[model samples]
Target: MNTLEQRYQFISLLGQGGMGKVYLAEDTKLSRKKWAIKEIPLTGMQRKQVISEVEILTKLNHQHLPRIVDYYTDEQQQHIYVVMDYIEGTTLQEVLKQKGVMDWKDTLHYSLQICDVFIYLHHDLAEPIIYRDLKPSNIMITKQNEVKLIDFGIARSYNQEKQDDTIKLGTIGFAAPEQFLDGQSDHRTDLYTLGSLIYFAISGKRYDQHATTPLHHVAKVPQELSSIVQKLTKHDAGERYQSAAEVKHALYKLLNKHDNNKKEQSITPMNIGTVMISVIATHKGMGSTHTAMMVAHHLNKKGYKVALIEANKSNEFKYIEEDYDGKQHKEVQTSCFSMHGVTYYKCEPTIEIATVIRLQYDFIILDIGCDLNQAWMGEFRRSQLRLVVGSAATWKKQKILDFVQQYEKEETKDWVYCIPFAESDQMLEIKSELRSKRMYAVPSNPYPMKLQEKTIAVFDEVLDHLPLNQKKKRLSIWWLLVPTSLVLAGIYVMMIVRM
Candidate 1:
């Protein structure tokens, strides 16, 4: 008997894959414990990858993941092997095949368990781990109905400091759009796969990554589940849930709603359209940055997706931009990121990119570094709101009035709002001097303060004026008028000819 045979007894072959063959084995020394033994033909590159996986596994201990029992490296024989707990039941792929499709309740149950493993892998560890490959075949369901993730061959610890691509590994229909590009894989990459898995479990159909319509439209999936899936699987990584914790939170909400049978509480998707607002400084000292930041944050708190943009040529946010991830937008020239509950972008003052940004967010807060000028006038005119900020100084107030009077059209006046930075007395003084009655005053606190009642009122006013996306009205039978008209014309001609 060989030395390897001394420790374990091979029962039978279970399965084989491109990388290795797995066998059913029993540990001879430990009460004949059942284990899975994977045998792989060593190639130099694959040998290094296997070693890396072992290093990662040594540090991981999770209920949902398989525990590493033993590993062997035989350089002379050009082969290597690993032993781990043999899951008692079948793979999710097999289960799906047998059952056709799982019920929403069961699917949600499995999805929540998967999220737990993801949170543990991405956050609990000292260094975040990116599960490069996540698919049905890699997951096993034990007799106890517990899920155990098996393959870690391609998983790697994510390097947040590095912005370049380190490695690319994923399965078709499960890989995020970033993996196919020069993009770095992070926590969001695994989120994309989770979305695809949920889609498959519910629809019993493979996900098409490029599909536009929501899952609810094509299948029996619920709208709430479908909406979350859409966000998770979005091609743009920034648009996806920021972290596994966030995804778990969303899933729990849906689970609670379903369990409570709150059918009437079902959410109707908001008709949020593109509403762009520009907050430009009337002078250098006026607080454009503070005003724009506050307003954007306020809207975000109201559940609107708002993006605060630094479009000024001076790039006033240079200090803030210094610490953001460098590899954020490798393909795109511009830098856009989400932080502290708000998305921020440093962009050139041009209409082209503004149009693109408008489509993605419900509102864009443009910090026109300085007073509005010709460079951004085109977009300013088209914007839903133009908020000009200035100090309480008479010169600045006059400048604001003159600017608005010259450029503000009679038809566009309703879209324009003004904010004056001042103290209690200064604000009242500015109101008397300023020509525009639509002006709102924001208190100047050298230190941070809560959103003031005046600021909230201003935001509420703005929201009231902005249009909401109404449910699209379906075409009625009235559209048949043209065909009916033609039919009547033909009948009249036939009658005339017969006469």
Candidate 2:
């Protein structure tokens, strides 16, 4: 049919599967906006199933999910049609076919996006929705590098009272053990399929639960990420990650660790440029402002132009001006002061990051206070590097967990955690609990102006390729040569005196 509902006009056939055909359609009533029209032949029970799918799609409102605009049944033709947003992209299956295998970073990015959709379905709704099927063909990647999940034919809402699903659904290799074993598939089932999807994305091969080979052994995947995949694909649902949030957090930790390694390896004397670093505290009294100031001064002393910005509502910079400088400056949109060769910008309601970026400083440091509701989060996300100043105390550790979990949807690859006054063992414990290696124990600095050796060492490790550290290494070599030369001169003078 050329037109349905007297509005959607069929343009071309997009694709066809066992269920039905999808067509590219244009809305005649509107400005010819494109949409995907799926037509499935009505059967004994399929008409009700199609209605169920429509209900699920209508309730969804996520960037990665398609919007169901219209749906109707063609009684004369015995077919049901669904009109939805036309996702213009290639499926993961097509990408895998062209490239054979995807890079781990690219796979991780897509996986994280899929997890966001899962979280919306499983936890954000009144009734939990279990996406019974997840495979490469169901995932689409746009030209702008965005992910979209398609094909909800097998999706179903979960019921806690039910002991088992009415029907067994899902692809063979990608399906969880419970899906095939007559057990009720739940949120963990989707996670199991996600692990298989990741394995297939990185290895260009299906994950065989029976095979002794592991994911890392088959592909050039990181052991930590591969281990997460293994945990996700465990035979028992209880053994797998219980929720998509947990899986997302584990993936975030892996991505952060990998990115830290790459950054440390890539840093060199020639490539040093304007780097933005954001410092945020998990709670009040976490010393985030002090940590930011110390970092600014340290970088400035290393012969780099540094700008320290107060992007939060703490007004610590204003307090410093009144107490230390003996003058209180009125707060405006932005105010500036200088201390220890570091330029400080007191920003009210947060200053434009672009404006500060245009000044072209070697390093721009933002101090984001404990309030997560502030507008400075945009700047924190835009910054090239992030430092989370949190407590290492066991009781206060929950704050750090909460902070990270809150932003689990964002990219955490460049994030580094700094715990003030934390012992080495404490840092180790937190790192292990979070499954992250991008953590540092910051020593207390009473005088922010003075750069202590311990503080310098911590910064040196966190921010690799410091000019000061390089100069010290050169000086150390000369230090060894100078002492040897003086000893030789003394021995020569003694021999001359004897002669």
Candidate 3:
């Protein structure tokens, strides 16, 4: 066991990859932190690809994920290793193969928690996140059965992918329908995989009788957990959970519903009320930021105490090309963030959103930064609502709807509401589609253009455009759900909690 601070510190090869090797290293700095360094073979294009991979992982941090502590090159082979929280635990696949399926309760408990991890990664972020792969080998379970999902080599910052890809990429047993067809994926694809994992948990199989028709197969799940899993695994995005928060809620409900009299665990649960939060999402440059600013401006003009939280990196260090007094000035820092004369807060990673609730603001418009790994995004789940923004084009509308449905189903959460950003023609199509799906009052046609304006300014017009008494999914402090719901296909709910 040689210990040195060199690049090849104690070359005990932990694992070998096609790209290169994973070495177990003793970090000389930072208290000799143990890191699993992934070294990519240095070739012509390999170097560039390695660089891009490192950039993607360097900025990511989540409770269920490993953080990238360091990245650099050592010797001829480019060293691109991510310093992760070394898990001495065995991979779930290994555990299952060696130890066999544990007690049903234990298996269910573990699988449900794993669902939480994906839920957090997807809807919990300001920008939607997508975990393209879900399988036993990729999941790790500790001695205490805590799940830590790893291997983001192919993950993207997204919650959903609308329209299947022409080609599919996933392990045969675990891939979803859309994945196999190269169709669109979103938050729901991960849920489908999750449902499959749970199927392995409750029963001794990886998939149910009709795994493809998950919504129909949902009734086989045990208790209220069935609702959560069915919704998450719906074949069509329209019938699924819309966000990770919703999934969390379903988990909470299933977990507590049974033991209403049981004592609850330690919780300084987020104090949230009235104050709403919505993220305007679209392909970058679709003017979502502008829409958010417009809504905020309109809300402010209506005598409402509103706050617009910007997750966009551009919000800070923004550039303004101005002809101030006929002199061309590029990149000017201006206070143009306030949505339509409304008071807004330009924020960073660790934000105090509780203050907004305490202030009793009637509304808050947030620019859900498309950039993944935002600091303030985790806090937005405490908000009263979410507004998804996309153009009225059929493709865009379908994408948004697909995302919401997937997120909701996979997470088993009900959205406060969904409002699509549309153009006039798209709005007509959207209206017809919404009616067909039994979802009414699809957002207004071409609400208002605030391209050169802030996104919050359009809040007022969007609000009025909301249909009479929007559909709201009632929330519970602790959403306790069962895990066998998918297997049993029943909406059984009971609580065992501190009442």
lDDT of each: 0.69, 0.80, 0.53
Q: Which residue pairs show collisions in model 2?
A: none
Query: Which model, 2 or 3, shows the larger TM-score?
Result: 2
- Which of the two candidates, 2 or 3, achieves a greater lDDT against the reference? 2
| lDDT agreement of model 3 with the native | 0.53
lDDT of 3 by residue, 92-147 (tens): 77877875554444555565566556665664556655676777777787543456
Encode model 1's per-residue lDDT on 22-134: one tens digit a residue.
88887776656677887777776666766766766755665567756568877474777787767777899999999887887688777777887898899878888989788
Which residues of candidate 3, in runs, are more than 4 Å off? 1-5, 8-11, 16-21, 40-50, 73-79, 102-108, 111-116, 124-127, 159-168, 207-223, 261-499
Candidate with maximal TM-score? 2
Stretches of model 2 off by over 4 angstroms after superposition: 207-211, 264-499
TM-score per model over all chains: 0.51, 0.55, 0.46
lDDT-better candidate, 1 vs 3: 1
Q: Of the pair 1 and 2, which is ahead by TM-score?
A: 2
